[model samples]
Target: MAVHPLSALLSGLVLAASAAHANGDAPAGGEPAAAAQVAGLWCGDGLLHEFSLRLNQDGEQVEGELLRKGRVRSIEGRIDGQVLRTQSTKVGALVLEKQGEELRVTGGDGPIALARGTSFRRSPGATCAS
Candidate 1:
């Protein structure tokens, strides 16, 4: 049986988030209040492709994953002032600026706009094995 592209991407993001929490990078219980504004899941619906992103911000350090059709890539970067700068294996370097509940990506193959979505979130007892 072949797994759906979205399923594989979600699985990869969950594993990455679990690892980050275990390594003391991501907050263990929940996202901190300070980072809540930029944390959680963001989704983008484009003409040709749809993308899902999970971002965990611990102070200035940001770690996350991006999932698109045929691709699952980890992203690492930091929040510099008002913008979040990250680099992905699939998309290269990108700059994200939050505008209300949306994130605007300017770099890589973007100008992509991702809106807040509830499909993915960090639970209190989330683990890699789950």
Candidate 2:
């Protein structure tokens, strides 16, 4: 069964949120606060599943892997203000923005099932485990 990259990507969103709460990073709202830096682990819980993403930032360049169901996809991009724009040779391109404590999907290329505005939380101390 071939899994769509977008589907796998969105799945990680749910897990990121779960990890955040477990780490005691969540506020009363049950969501963790967003970090100023893009370099770290992020998780998101989608309507259907969970997923994780790990990012490393150096200056303006950002590189990371999005993980779901033991599969990993490499992505690279740049940051401008609160927005992170990333591209993957296998998964295509995606754009995310930090809004308060959530990293929301703002845009993307190609036909994607992951909706724009789908959000993920910063998973501090969370590792991108397969």
Candidate 3:
């Protein structure tokens, strides 16, 4: 049997996070990093565009891949309090906050530019295909 590349990557990430936690290097906040609600696959649709975010959160640090307008880009950021802030050369900066079952893009500049209030839903079974 063969393991998917993404699965392998995520597994490695989980291991690293566990090791860090065991070493007393948890996130700055009082809450456990494993409690992060943004660590999952999310998707959103707009009037003219669709995007998907495959995020992995390890403590305050976040690493993920973003799919927007059929283009894919790797993104890295940190969780500041309740917001996840990510930056990419192609997309500038993106600030996301979890609201109930949605992850809303509170502020940011993407190539296609989503509105400030645009929200994404957790879609773990969804693909990045646009």
Candidate 4:
């Protein structure tokens, strides 16, 4: 299958964030930790579609892959305060408000509530790659 362009972009963003973190270039404050808290695999099941997202967050930057109906799209965004704002080629702009462990996604046709997928693993050794 041909790789999606958005996937490449998101992957680059993740790599850049990792490099910045490694270089100690990440902004100082609680933002990094706060963003880190949002890093995980999240899933939402609807009557018509099942949505899954695997996110890696460092500082205010977020990179992830969203899967719905067997189609994978890359997500790139930033967190400001308690809201995570992201955009994808397929979904356009998406706003997710953090409420406890759930992310209420909006800015789409309809809203979706995504819960942390505790049983989902991004890799064999990594629970959710960061």
Best by TM-score: 2
How many residue pairs collide in each prediction? 0, 10, 0, 0
Give the backbone clash total of model 3: 0
Give TM-scores for every candidate, taking all chains together and pairing residue i with residue i: 0.50, 0.63, 0.62, 0.52
Q: Which ten residues in a row have the lowest lDDT in candidate 2?
A: 27-36
Backbone clashes in model 1, listed as residue pairs: none
Candidate 1 weakest ten by summed lDDT? 121-130
Candidate 2 C-alpha lDDT tens digits along 1-130? 9999999888897788778777756754875444347778788657413677788998778999877777888889887657788875655677888776677888887543255768777775655323
lDDT of 1 by residue, 8-73 (tens): 999999998898777656576645323325677676534323666777888888888776774777
User: In candidate 3, what residue range of length 10 has the lowest lDDT sum?
Assistant: 28-37
lDDT of 3 at 45: 49
Alpha-carbon local distance difference test for all models: 0.60, 0.72, 0.74, 0.62
Ranking of all candidate structures by their TM-score, best first: 2, 3, 4, 1
- Candidate achieving higher TM-score, 1 or 2: 2
Candidate number with greatest lDDT: 3
Q: Model 1 reaches what TM-score against the true structure?
A: 0.50
